[model samples]
Target: MVLAYLLSVIFTQPVVTMEAEAIQPVALRPVANLKAKDTPNDAGQSIDLSWELSPDSARVKRYEVYRAESAKGPFEKIVEFLVPTTAYTDADTLLRNKKDYYYRVDVVGELESRASSEIAGPVQAKPEWFNTNRIPVLVFAVVYGLLLILYIEFAKRDREMFVRRIAGLDAIDEAVGRSTEMGKPILFSFGIGYLTDVATLAALSILRRVARRAAEYETRILVPNYDPIVMTAAQETVKQAFSEAGRPDLYQEGDITFLTADQFGYAAGVNGIMLREKPGTVFLQGVFYAEALILAETAHSVGAIQIAGTNMATQLPFFIAACDYTLIGEELFAASAYLDRDPQLLGSLKSEDIAKLITVGLIVVVSVVGTIGAVLTSVSGESGILRSLTEFFNSGFERLVSFLTTS
Candidate 1:
């Protein structure tokens, strides 16, 4: 009798516990405080939605977002978040501008159990005329414009603007004089460039300077061009330079002639002139490619004083190694301002320098701040002072980036 009574108690207790466990409810909770609004600082046809997380977020398998033109009846699911998320931006093409929208968020739990938040409504997407977040960019642009204008005015007022001398340009007279003393011709090649090229245009300014000096010294200047249009322009430039130097009679149109438009063909023609004439000074300016080294070396073989200037970087090292003087990159562009010292050009050049200074200063400041913030974050551990310093630096870094990049 005792054994039967014990067995009945054990089996009945096990059954009761199992039934209670099966009946216990799954704790599912809906998201709350759902909000929807037009996205800021953007073109029309977008809306932003946000919500508080469900209390049973750990059990949530995913969150689904729905949109409707009206709050009542059918709503279509526009997007879903497989992981927990608090916010979403609906930039779908179907979202029309100025049309009202309603949004709802649903928390899906394990085993298909679902709960939904109250609907959020009456939001319309619209475009903004100006993005307020880009105020920093506008401010910087305005400041640069004002600086440019002010400098131009100062230059026009006859205020002496100090400009550093470019050695390549300053040697123009020396190169022409050397050819004059040696009683040999000056060879100038506009290596395979069209009149439409900016580098070719910049080279024209340097050509004018060389031509003027050559005219003053009564030395013959030969300009071999690759493009016929460029040949015409070069002829006019040299004529003007000679007229400016009061030596128009010395201007020779035949000296500035077009060679072939073919790349290597033009280079060979220039090389032939360098070899036959064995010029005292060779001015290699404008666009050049594989022929840069060939021309520079040929001029060197003729024992010519080579003054090379081009906007091409690939050919610069070859010229620098083979030629006596070389103008690197933007120095070729700045030739007009440096040689002519025109007020407008000087003002523009100086303003660009100031702009560059501002950019470099900002970059340095940001780099230092970011480095310090990272170091502080790693060492803060348990120290409240260090942690506060880390937060301060991090906040400043974020603000700087946002100010520069956002909107």
Candidate 2:
């Protein structure tokens, strides 16, 4: 009996050891104080969530946020991973203000997570009417507006702000006089642009000056238009110009005619007009495409005094090669200010020119310093005054760029 009892005790001891080994430890610890609210100054499509960190957060590496449309929950994870800052703004609510949203935050670890003891919210989002990020742009716009207004006021006083005389605009009197002396019509077209184009508008401004001269000189002006809208604007422009020149009776309705909208077809009509009329002066200003060379070469063949102005860099070479006088780049844009000498336009033009000169000076200084610095760095690894000057210039340039772009 003693021997049997000892064997049974040994077997029973092994079974009890196996049962103790099978038991495992649980890893979850509940997170606390989860809350959700509407995000401020946002479109009605966002909710802000927050929670307190778990006291047993030793294993917590991230927080996960889950959201559901109802309290009973088929909760879906909204955020994949977030740092434990107890704050998360959910910005994907969409057009769902009428529905309540419930939220849960989980303390996440390597392989598991402990959810918040209670769900966060029945929250709704509201839209803000204004965006604060555009404040910098608005402030700068106001500053520039004030500067423009002051410049205009000063110009009106005839404060004698000298703007450089544009050679192309200056030659206008010579061209118009030649047409008047020859007893022939002057052909004027605003390139092949729609009326909405600013280049076309600028061309129209110069035409106002041209039409007034034609009216005063008792010279005939023929304007062939590619767009109907441009045709209407041109007629009105000429009529007003004639009225201003005290020759509204001389304003001919047939002078400004609408040609086909087809680009090459319009060029053909202008070419035919040039051949038939043999105009003494041809004014081509605005935007042009491939037809620029065609019109310019034809005008040259007609032995006409051609004055052309265009903002298109590609067409500028054609005009320069053919026309007697060509207004390059921004000169075309400033035709009004040059011709009218309107105090407001003149003041703005002078101010802009000054700004451009300043910009050029800064670019030149920065370029020289940078070049010198690079040479010194290549020879002696920036050990001298050249290097120091270069670094100072570079730093100032960087600051200026940052202020302009990022502010």
Candidate 3:
């Protein structure tokens, strides 16, 4: 409006003839040292532009920047309003890495506006493969990986890394011993869950150990499975266990039988076996449903020493009440490692333990710092050094946690 009004007023005060509408233009000093280059540390579709302030910048109202594909006059004004700063970043541009961009700055003064004599050009936006933002996460992954490998090596060397004894796991030998002394069969049941489940797999491993012990004691072992796959796997496990115990002759494929997959029907079948055969030791380890208490209570009434473990939390109280010993939650998952003490298992266990310790330590540190930050923020107001320190700590702590648990 200012430029248009000035032009109309000057041009309208005409003399005559050809010189009637001609008005002389006023001079304005353009910005100096204008430059543009591809932005650093980014997946580039952008460029950074900077320049020395105009000599007439104090007199000038503002400056406008323009961009063009070519070095000539057909430039588009990118800055709709005049910008006060001497520096700007032109991020919205054609992202084809092969294309070059040209930029010029125009200084607007009270009298007239002038374009910079030079334009920065030929700067190409390029993509970067390496993203620097995720360096913390990458660093954490490498460090945590190295730590796990180191602990695994330590375990392989037979170093005693103590894992607290689980009472439920420790009673397996006693249960097998009772079954042997009573001259009754030891019954192991992996409820409806298939061999694909981790809990079921752990149960199978524990069953293998129990079967071996039963073989050594010259005692019979029975595994009534719901899933046909688990039945087959159970037979193999029992066979392998007997073979390992030097009692291949004692292995019986029929003992690890395939019962119905129906939950209550399977429970009814197991209950009947408990009543008829009255196995001295009943092992229930797997996924179960409404039939959990039905089986556990029936076995309880039969005077069997039951050792039960399941991934299902809802059935835990029933097992704890009815069974002699119950492996709860993670104890069920840890059964195989607890029984065998394999270096690989122990290594994984210890590495996970270390990771847990680190996580807990971070949590504690973060909690205390965050609490202090909150209190200081409320009491002393948010503008102090204490608040700043807390803010800094909290941010760093959050980043650390996010990095650790990233994937």
Write candidate 2's Cα lDDT for 182-219 as tens digits: 99899998879998898999999989999999999999
In candidate 3 the C-alpha lDDT for residue 328 amounts to 93
lDDT top scorer: 1
Q: TM-scores of all models?
A: 0.62, 0.63, 0.61
Q: Rank the candidates by TM-score, best first.
A: 2, 1, 3
**How far in Å is the alpha carbon of 127 misplaced in model 1?**
11
Segments of candidate 3 deviating more than 4 angstroms: 1-145, 380-382, 386-390, 393-407
Model 2 spans > 4 angstroms off: 1-143, 361-407
Q: How many backbone clashes does candidate 3 have?
A: 0
lDDT of 1 by residue, 23-138 (tens): 76465889999999999999989999989999999989999999999989488999899999999999999889998888899998766778988999989999999998879888
Cα deviation of 119, candidate 3, in Å: 32
**lDDT, candidate 3, 1-407, per-residue tens:** 99999998788656443463244444678888889888776878888889888776666777888888888857888883354677888888554564788888888765455656488886787777887667866776776788779988998898997888999889999999999999999999999898788889989888998999999999999888899999988999999999999999999888889889888889989999999999999999998888888989998888899999998989898899889899997888877778888887878777777776877887787677667666665666557787687677667667655764563
Clashing pairs in 3: none
Worst 10 residues of 2 by lDDT: 398-407
lDDT (C-alpha) at residue 166 in model 3: 90
Number of residue pairs clashing in candidate 1, backbone atoms closer than 3 angstroms, sequence gap of 3 or more or interchain:
0
